[model samples]
Target: MPTAKRPPKPPPKPYHHGNLRETLLVAADAVLAERGAQGLTLRDVAKAAGVSHAAPYHHFASLNDLLAAVAERAFGLLAQALEQAATEPDTAERMLKINDAYVACALARPAQFRLMFGPLLARKHDYPEFKVAAERAFGVVLTAACAHDPERGPELALTGWSLAHGLSNLLIDGALEGLPIPVGPGEGLARQLAVRALGVTGAAA
Candidate 1:
C-alpha cells in the first residue's frame, strides 16, 4: 500500500524574536549590506527577518523609516569610533585619529556608510533620530577641531569634516586607485592621505 503523505511542516513557527523592533532593525542591516539602499524594501526586510511581509510594517511605515533606523545605528557606531580617537590629548594626533577612524568605519561597512549619508536618509527633518545621531557624531570632530584652533574652531571643523567625507567617498567609489601614490595597503594609504592632506603630525603609522 502507498504510505500516507507526510504532515505539512509547521508554518515556520511565525518567526519570533524577543523584540520584534530590534529584530527588524538587525534584518534591515543585513539587507542593506547585501543590497544598497536603492535595493532595500519593506517586503525584502520582512522576508530576511523570516516574518510575514506585513511584519515590518508593524515597526516601520515605509522603506525610508527602516532606512532611518539603520542610519541612526550607523551614526551611533561612527560616533563611538570618533570618540575613541578623541581620547588622544594631542590636537593634530587627535584630528588624524578621528579622520582615520572615519575612513576605517567607511571601509569596514561601505554600504552602511553610504546609507548613513545618502540623500534619501540624510533628510534631517524627516528623520529626527538620524539627524540627532549625525549631529552627535559631527560634534566629535567639532570638539577636536576647537581644541586644535580656538580662533577658527567652526571653520576647522568644517574643513576636517569635508576632507574626511571626500576621502571616504573616493575610497569607497574606488577613485583612489587612480592616484599616483605607491600601492600600499588600502587603510594605510587612506590614513596617510588624511594625515598629509590635513597637515596632521605625530600620527602613528
Candidate 2:
C-alpha cells in the first residue's frame, strides 16, 4: 500500500498591498509620530501597514533604508513648505516666509524633523534621494537669500539655515519657552526670531 502525500501550500501568496511602498511610507510616518526613530522597525511598519511581517523587505533592505526613505519624504515636504515663501513679491518678505516655513515644518512634524537631522542618519551618501531632497530644500533658501543680497547670498543662506535650524530644535525641545522673548504664542515667537535672523524687516511694515 502507498501512502498519499498532500501537495505543498502555495508560497503563502506574497502579501500584496496595492500601493505597498507608499503604504509602508505612511505606516513608517505614523510609527515615527507615535514611537520616534528608535522605536521604528520593519515589522512594526508592516503591521501598521496591514501587511505581512516580511513585506517591508520587498521595498527596504534594512531599517536604515526605510528610515532614509522617510527622511527623503520629510525633506520633500520641507522643500515645498520653503517654496511657498518664494511667492512673495519682495525678496526680504520671501526670505522671511522661507524661514517661517522652515520652523513651521519642523514644529508640525517634530519626530520626522528629528529623524531627518539626527546623527544616526547623518550618512547622506547612503541615501541619494534624501541628499537630493535636502539640497533642493536648502537651494530654496539660498535662492531667496541671493535675491535678498546678491553679494552676501551664500553667507546669508548658511546663516539663515543655521538660525532656522537652531530655532526649530529649540522649539521642539521646549527650550524656547524659557527665552525672554515677548511673544503671544510659540508660532509668533518663532516667526519673529526667524525674521530677525534673516534681517528681513520689510515684511514687518
Which model scores highest in TM-score?
2
Residue 202 local lDDT, model 1: 50
1-205: candidate 2 lDDT, tens digit per residue: 8989999887867456789999999999999999999867899998999988888888999999999999999999999999987888888878877887898899999999999998635798878888998899999999988988999999989988898899789888988565685545555765676666666675652
Tell me the whole-model lDDT of each prediction, alpha carbons only. Answer: 0.84, 0.85
In order of appearance, the predictions have TM-scores of 0.87, 0.88
Candidate 1 lDDT tens digits, 1-205:
9999999887766556678889899988998888888867898988888888888878788888888889899999999999999999888888888888888898899999988888855477898888899999999999998898788878878877888788788878988686786666666765676666666675474
Regions more than 4 Å wrong, model 1: 1-16, 178-183, 203-205
Among all windows of 10 consecutive residues in model 1, the one with the lowest summed lDDT is: 196-205
**Each model's Cα RMSD:** 3.6, 4.0
| Highest lDDT model number | 2
